[model samples]
Target: MDPRFLGIPELTTEAPSVAVVVDVMRACTVAAWAFARGAERIVLTGTLDEALALKARHPDWAALKDGPPAPGFDLVNSPGQLRSADLGGRTVVQKTTAGTVGALAVRDASLVLCAGFVVAEATARVLRERAPDEVTYVVTGEDGRADEDLACAQYIAGRAAGGSPDPAGYLRRAAASRAAAELTQGVRRGSHPDDVALCLELDRFPFAMVAAEEDALLVLRRYDGNP
Candidate 1:
């Protein structure tokens, strides 16, 4: 089946068998990096408060958020930060402005996955392997105006359809996006230039980030084709 790209707000308009939430500017990229750093799973939350509260309850899990780390949180939601941190297989509780909200809003998808350029090809592979009749790519930036997320979604969609999508073409569009510029504005809005560079790397990870329900909480874990 062909893949459908939808803005985060339009998720409720249709029920998708598989929902791939794209947040290329940072959130999903951070998730991908966290896994690479040995984090066990990420608990997706809609609000920073929820992530903080969960962290407080566990006291062992890391709390990651967009912008600077909150008082009790472990680190900022940047792939650069996760790159240096050793999670020791601990769970991460994550909250972001767009990615987490869009991911949590998906109500009826049988499978919900997180995607960014870093995990683009792996995500497409998951979609192809699952062979779901309905696949929706949720652009989780600026209600879909964010070019980085849109381009990544298009690339993944094309690949999931068994085509060899042009990564250079998609990279050009994503790098030129306003979202990409903002992340490189030198600590503006708690974003860093390193993050922009890191998030734009294509297929940096070889696994998809799958968000699954565990004990009534949405948890994201590395998925490498196994159900």
Candidate 2:
């Protein structure tokens, strides 16, 4: 059957045959890197305090916390930082404004896969192979509302189920936004432009990491790589 889309609230009762959680702004991208770098697991939490608590309790596990700036934490939801860190044989606990929360919201799915624009093709290929009875794409939004998440959902939904995505249009808009931002005026002018460029590379990592509650973290690795 074709894959379907559902918001987080809709996930309360209806258990998805397979659910893919997306936070394209950064979280899922970082998770992908963590998996690539040999991270055993990643615990995704909604609050920084919860992540910190997890870290304190499990000192053996390498904990990395991320969220909005106002309420600070160990990290600031940047994929660059995650890539730079050596996560070999470590378990990262992530807290983000939207991504990790979205993962937690889809607590009822039989199988959950983390996704983002970076791994969109990989995600669709996995869905096609699994061909689950039903598929739900959950887009975790900032401030508990949909915008980029929904746009990304629409893009993936079209691809996974045999439709079309306006890739050019989307790229144009994204480029326009970046062009509009006068970064030179900012305090940190030359900060990590390569990082943003790296995040835009589609399907750089040939994997889809799934969250495992047995260890309360994502099990890193590839999903089959067959598209």
Candidate 3:
């Protein structure tokens, strides 16, 4: 069967066997870059305070939030910042505005994965390999009105359905989105200029980011296994 697309995460019920959350503007892109940089694992939190508290307790883990780095956090949730950090074997605590919240809201799904243009192809491959009876694509940005996330979700959903969708076309739509404009504004303010470009790097990672509950906390990690 074809994949189901969701807008408001809070109202989602009876989620399919697999749920793929997309936040192409930044959150999922950040995850892809962090894993690419060799971060051990990412602990996703809904609030900045929760992430900061976790960082305080761990002391060794890297803390990141949506905008600029907070007092207790190490960096912002930007791919450019993650690319420079030596995240090798370090745990990352992350709090974002939409991505992590949408992810954690998904219930009754056997597998929950995060996706952006960076890992879109890899995520589709994983879905095709697993071949779940049902799949749900959660566009976790601006109640699914965010063009970047919606475009990325459409691309992945098409690929998972055995179609060769033109990623360049999707990229164009994503670039014209409000989220992209926000990133551009962020760059002008010296908030990681490279992030705007980095988030659009299609198929940059070959691994998928999977989220699961561990020790009562939502944890994200790379899943590079065959079905």
lDDT values, one for every candidate? 0.85, 0.62, 0.84
Query: For residues 110-162, what per-residue lDDT tens digits would candidate 1 score against the true structure?
Result: 89989999998888888888778878888989887888999999999988889
Q: Best-fitting candidate, measured by TM-score?
A: 1
* Winner of 1 and 2 under lDDT: 1
Per-residue accuracy of model 2 over 1-227 as CA lDDT, tens digit each: 45556666666665666778876656777778777767777777776677777878887766554433433334445566566767778777777656777777765567778886677777777777777767777866543244445555666666777666766555443333332132212322322445445445666876666654665544434464642
Compared with the true structure, the alpha-carbon lDDT of candidate 3 equals 0.84
Rate residue 31 of model 2 by lDDT.
79
* TM-score per candidate: 0.95, 0.77, 0.94
Q: Is candidate 1 or candidate 3 better by TM-score?
A: 1
RMSD in angstroms, all models? 1.4, 4.3, 1.8
Lowest lDDT sum, 10 consecutive residues, model 1, at 184-193
Q: Which segments of model 2 are wrong by more than 4 Å?
A: 67-75, 143-147, 162-166, 173-195, 215-227
Q: How far is candidate 3 from the true structure (C-alpha RMSD, Å)?
A: 1.8
**How much is the lDDT of residue 80 in candidate 3?**
76
lDDT of 1: 0.85
